[model samples]
Target: MKRSVLKFGGSSVADFPKIKDISLYLKERIEKGEQLIVVVSAMGKTTDNLLASVHDLTDNPNDKDLAMLLTTGEQQTISFLSLVLNDIGVRAKPLTGYQAGIETIGKHLKSKISSIKGDLLENLFEEHDLLIVAGFQGFNKEGELTTLGRGGSDTTAVAIASAMQCPCEIYTDVTGVYSTDPRIFPEAKRWDQISFEEMMEMSALGAGVLETRSVELANNHNIPIYLGKTLSDEKGTWIVPNDQILERKAVTGVALDKEMAHITITYPSHDRQFLSDLFKLLEDAEINVDMISQIQNQDGQQFSFTFKESDEKELIRLFNALKETYPDLYFKIETTYCKVSVIGAGMRDMTGVASKIFKTLLDADITFYQVTTSEISVSYVVDEANGEKATRLLCQTFNL
Candidate 1:
């Protein structure tokens, strides 16, 4: 069977009309001999509205109850889409994450998918060519409903594709992957294909097209991902292995992330153990940190790192409590920072990439708060005000 896993974002299934359009599109695909496993997110602003209702009820809602309530969003999507598909004479089965055997283990709000029983999916596929599964949710060992955190829908789609060993096609609002966000670079060209490693770096560094974990899952499972606009004729972008990439540019893309906070923590002593203890707390709190730089200050050791700006409130609470133990510890967080990164597999053999980036920022009189590099990417944290300008300049210079 020419089978594939397909995912539609919240916008793609926003209402009955959109869902109907998707059904028509799927009918054509099925007629062309493609069997599909479809995944869908909540309708437009559904998750947000649901969250708002909960927040109105209580400022600090229990994560377990929140997970149970929030998952209803995806459940509604799956129910609606399946009804439309079935009404259109296409055999469809709507399955929740639990019904589909997506067992996850972790905290209630941001659980990690631990295993999926492929037999359940296989059984459904035998009766219906279209199996609609709710994204971003699953069940834990105790049979409690759990939700995956941000970008969880993307993770759900890719994980299923990996389990089935099939290509995954993600339909969204955009046409394809661009050299940079088109809002930032109107002239940015869309790539026909991108390497998995490059895509992963771009996603992590800044591009919001695909989540890092999803791309990483696709890469490890050797599952190709095609990103395209929903119900469009455009072929979109293909993410695959490095050797499968037809062209390798010096710098394929530049991404700008505005939702990052920079933190500088200074301790009173050269205590590496302090660093360990601090990071342990961060890990336990499930904070995703990046671009860490450890430096030696005149008095002691200083560490600078960047994390999601959304985590600022939680981090403040964490640091405030830590201060009780170490009265002299100094920690300052600046939320108005943007992380800009240039990503390309070609950079593996390329030099002067960093120099070019630094010179571009210098000529623009933009100061980089921090800098980090890898085999194929370079990231810089700059004032949020200069982020778009710096990204545009680098995009132009790199011909991205």
Candidate 2:
């Protein structure tokens, strides 16, 4: 029998009706001689509601306790899906991360998956052709429940597929990946096929169609992933290796990351030791720092970096530690900003792509605060309000 792992996002299995529909869909597929493993996220907005409740009690909820609480969302989904499948006469078994033998090691809120029980899964498959597994939640060595951060379910599904050596299918609200967020611009064009490299860049830059880590893992393992709308026969995009495709667009996509914060620090003098120590501190704190810039002169040195807003509280706490030593150290931090990125593989061999990007934004009178570039990408930090405008403008300019 052909075996594959499939994942459905929250919106797809938001309620009993949708869950039943998906169960029936899988039943038909199973009857057609295919073995399946289904991964599910929390029901629609369940995780958000749980988060609101946690923050309602305290701003600094304990990570261990938070992990315990949040993982129930996916567990609820798995059991409910299992019930639906069973009621419809399908041999389905629901498994949580621990029950499914998924182990991880990292912070409770953002754990990295370390292992999966492929032999156990295949053994279970002998009796039941279908296994419904909870997504986004895994257990650490300490036996504590851990989540893979937001959009982690995508990673879970991909990891399981990698273990099984099969192509993975991810179904979400969108029919497929787009050049930009369709909600921001309804005219955003969708791609029939995208390279894993381009997909990773888009996810990291805030396409949000799939988790960045999932794409990275799939890329590393040479796994192909199919993204499409759930419960629909619509043709979707295929994410494959770069060498599989012959043509490359100059600018394939534009992404706007709204969860970014900009922080700038000014030191009294250029101190290499202090810089190294601060970076080490950030690393210890697991701060996701990006686009660091530094300037030095006879007077002092200025340092700037961007990180997700979710880490702002931890970052502030870290800064407090530095205050006792460098009382005169100055820093400016702002959360009301977003990063707009232009990405394409063709930029590696094509020239002037950056020129057209900046010129387009400048002609629109949108002032960007910071700019960073890579071989195949250029990103700019701009006011949050202008993020949509910049995305639309750039997508149009690039004909994305």
Candidate 3:
């Protein structure tokens, strides 16, 4: 018998009424002979509330304590969802990530899925009418609770589906993956299907279409993701294995991110040793540089490079810490910034992708400070205030 894994996001399982509606949706699927495993996120903004409590208590709360606090949100959802299913005369069992055998490594807030022993889950699905598993939280070999950090719920769902060898359907607030954010561009159309590569780049480039890690897992395990809206029967985007037919034009989507800072290090001269030393500084500070670009000075000696502003604070901290050693190597940090990216697989083989994207911005009279690209995506750094306007104009030009 074919099995299907269904995951509902915070909005999908938000309230009692929404739970009831989702329960009906599941019940009908079960009645039709589909073996079901439902993964659910924390009800509404429960996780956010818990994080708020953590923030109030400590500047950097212990990882173990935070994980314990975060797990409760999903636990509440699982228990309530199981109860709702039972109330509807369906036999359902709620399981935590531990009980379902989602094992991981790492302490506290940043754990990665190591392995999943699904025997218990298999038994429950065989014995019960439905199985409801809490998403996001997992356990390690030592039986310590762990989490996959931000956007963990989506990763949880994809991991479960991959481990169980079934397609996972994700229910969120949007009807499907849109060319652009519908909130910003009301006329944007939802895509019928998106290749995993495109989706991965889109998510990583700040599209928020799906969690990047989830897309990575799906692509790794060859699992399909059905994205749909929770509030309606609208068929959302289907993220599947890379398909030639599904590939779009030079640009498939546009994305903008507001959380960025820029840091540039200019030293006395452009030397390989200085470049290596600077990167080591970032590594020591644990700053992840995104969209980095380097240019040689006119003298062909000194060098300057730019990275996201999110790394600005740490870069400065590290520089100040080492100011005595490399006074000349110290540089300035800039924080006010945003990045807008045009992501697609077609861009790799196309000629005018970048030209068209930049032209759209020029036509809109939007001044961009920087431009960067990978084989699958191109991004521009622009003023934070014009982020949405840039995204809308690019979306219109690409007809995304």
Candidate 4:
């Protein structure tokens, strides 16, 4: 029998009433003879609340214990969802990451799916109409629970879909993927179809519609992802191969990333080996460095880099460690910046995209601290307050 995976975000399964509504949606699909696997996130703000509670108790908690505490949120959703479905006369079974056989490998709080033992899931399909799996968590080889950090649930849904060789449907609060965030630009247009590469770029550039890791996983496994609202019948966006998109635009979307921190470090020497060693430390720490700039003078060299705000503490810890090695190293941190980017697969074959982006920002009199470009996208760092304005102007300039 063919199988399909449907993933509901936190907002969709927020309360009992919402869970009952999702059961109805699943019941309709079961009536149509669709074998289903439902992956769900924690209830609305449940994970955040859990983290807050933990922090209130202690400033520093053990990573393994923290992951153990966090996994309970998704586990709660799985149980509640399964109970709701059974109440509606639909046969549903609930499984945690371990029970479902999602094996992972990495650090405690942020692990990646190493592989899945899918025989258990295949067997469950015989007796149940729907299998409810908790998202965002799995057990590592040491038999310890681990979470996937941000977008962990989305990664779980896509990973299961890939293993099952089925299409994945992600149900969120939005109707579909928009050219830009609708809240930032009310006139932003929603896309009916988007190429995986385009979506990947947008996701990586800070589009919140889908997680970047999920898109990368889907693309790697050649799976198509359907994104839509949980309860609405409105049409959503299809993320597929680039070849499947007939008409490609020069600029498909604008994305804004507000959670960023900029750091600049000045060293006493201009030696190349010093810079390499500093970056090697960051690499070993798994810090994702972006938008890097280097300036050198007769006195010393200064390096600037941007990274996710959430990683600021880790970065600072590494900086302190490095300071012990280079006693004269001076560093400054700025948390008031955001990155706005324009993405389009068509940019690979188009010209003047960078110029257009710069001209647009210049015409708007927006001051940018740094600029970076990939083959298919151009990114600029501006003050957090101007993020929306930059995104809107880029969207209109490209007619996205």
Q: What's the number of clashes in each of the models?
A: 0, 0, 8, 0
Query: Which consecutive 10 residues in model 3 have the weakest lDDT in total?
Result: 299-308
Could you tell me the TM-score of candidate 2? Answer: 0.97
Residue lDDT tens for model 2, 115-151 = 9999999999889979999999899998888999999
C-alpha lDDT of all candidate models, in order = 0.91, 0.92, 0.82, 0.92
- Mind giving the per-residue lDDT tens digits that candidate 4 earns over 1-400? 5679999999999999999999998999999989999999999999999999999999889999999999999999999999889988999999999998999987888788998877789898889999999999999988999998888899999999999999999999999999999998899988999999999999888998888889999999999999999889899999998889999999899999998899999997977877877889987777889999988898899899999999999888888998897889999999999999999988989898999988999999999989899988889999999999999898889987
Residue-by-residue lDDT tens digits, candidate 1, 1-400 = 7999999999999999999999999999999999999999999999999999987899878899899999999999999988888888999999999999999998898799998888779887778989999999999999999988888999999999999989999999999899999998899999999999999999998799998889999989999999999988887999999889776888999999998998999897997778778988898889999998888977998888999987898899899888887788999998888999998888888788888988999999999878888999999989899999999999999987
RMSD of each: 1.4, 1.2, 2.9, 1.1
Candidate 4 lands at a TM-score of 0.98
Clashing pairs in 4: none
Give per-residue CA lDDT, model 3, range 235-324, as digits (tens). 788898876344467777888877677766666665676667767887755456776666677654443445545456556677786566
